[model samples]
Target: MTDSLQNLVSPEEWQARIDLAAAYRLVALYGWDDLIFTHISIKIPGTEHFLINPYGMMFEEITASSLVKINLSGEKVSESPYPVNPAGFTIHSCVHAARHDAQCVMHTHSINGVSVSAQKNGVLPLSQQSFFVLSSLAYHDYEGVALLEDEKPRLVHDLGDKRFLMLRNHGLLTVGSSVAEAFLGMYIFEATCMIQVRAQSGGGELVLIPQKILDMAPAQITQVTLGMGGSLAWPALLRKLDRVNPGYRS
Candidate 1:
């Protein structure tokens, strides 16, 4: 099945599948998955098509050949032995439709993330990681589970060109030019929230990063990464995955 699926798509798309599948496994490895809930979607480059997880599969169980290909409407466009979660597509499809630059969209219902989302201040500039998120964060008040088409417009409006989105009373989301980029963004986002939650529990006065430094984070990060950003760490991440969870590439 793996070989057959690999043969069915272009080399570009197959690589996309492997990267996205690896992302799902990495999410699980980090203990961020929510019992088969939430989603990470990657748009097939230069096409309106997308690849999403098969419904009912744990993130650790997702493989390159098991991802289901679908069109913008969330309807399956390929012959797969699995079904998709239509409700999951509500957020992903909307993001893909509105943000052409977002080749990958990742959403998570992580405990630390949701805890931060429920906070009135959202992501505060409490740590260096927070600076990366605050520099590009947006917020959307949760309007129930994202299962309606009408909600898409409001969700898109709230996202509005931002890379990180805090779904109030819900979770965290990040969009990027690739699976690696999106995953890295989420890592920073989740770390920010975790630090915030821990700091709040400490009952000590939290010293925020100065506004000037916070403002300079984006440019500093660009320089530090030499413009490679997530791609710089992606190969290493893949190697880690290969050692810890090896089946995603299949």
Candidate 2:
């Protein structure tokens, strides 16, 4: 299957295929999958075409060759045996259209993500993880299940330059200039939500990180991680996926 894909797709596209497939597998690996409900889209380098998981396949079942390529209008630019969900692509399409700097868009409905989204106060500065998320977080009020065309502007408007987006009353979304960044951003975002929910469940007074400290999160994070972005951590994640689900590369 990989050989077939290599013959059919350009080298860059094939790598994108593998990276996107790995993301699907990782999403499922971390138990973030919603049984084929959420979608992840990545723009193909040097083209307007983007790749998404084919509808009906669980995230764990996605593979490099199995992904479907579609244009911004949700139209398939290449032949794919699988179909894409128009309704699911609605929010994804809008984000990619508005954030040209964003090369990858990831949407998830992890239990904690939705739980926190429904909260009166979204993400708070309680834990160190929250610092990274709060630094670039934005919230968009839910506008019903199906994302209408008019809603595109408002959604993008809310997202602005933020990497983390909380779809109020709905779920969570992340955007990145690369697949690695989006996945890494989502890891922090999702973890922040899970930790916050559990910490609050203790029903005791919580100590909050000072707002001034949070203001230095960007520099601190870079220092803590040795100035390495998601790229530095992504290979290790893929190796973990290979140990559990090597089929994603197919």
Q: Which candidate leads the pack in TM-score? A: 1
The residue-by-residue lDDT of candidate 1 on 1-250, one tens digit each, is 4344788789999999999999999999998899899999999986789999998899998999999999989999988888898888999999999999899999999999999999998998898889888889999998999999999999999999999999999999999999999999999999999999999999999898898888797798788875327988899999999999898888
User: What digit string (tens of lDDT, one per residue) describes model 2 on residues 76-138?
Assistant: 888877888888999999999889988999999999999999998999898978999988899
Please give the range of 10 consecutive residues that has the lowest summed lDDT in model 1: 1-10
- TM-score of model 2 (CA atoms): 0.96
lDDT measured at residue 191 in model 2 versus the true structure, 0 to 100 = 94
Superposed model 1: Cα runs more than 4 Å off: 1-4
TM-score of candidate 1 against the unseen true structure: 0.97
Candidate 2, superposed: residue stretches over 4 Å from native: 1-3, 226-228
**Each prediction's TM-score versus the true structure:** 0.97, 0.96
Q: Output candidate 2 Cα RMSD.
A: 1.5
Model 2: worst 10 consecutive residues (lDDT sum): 1-10
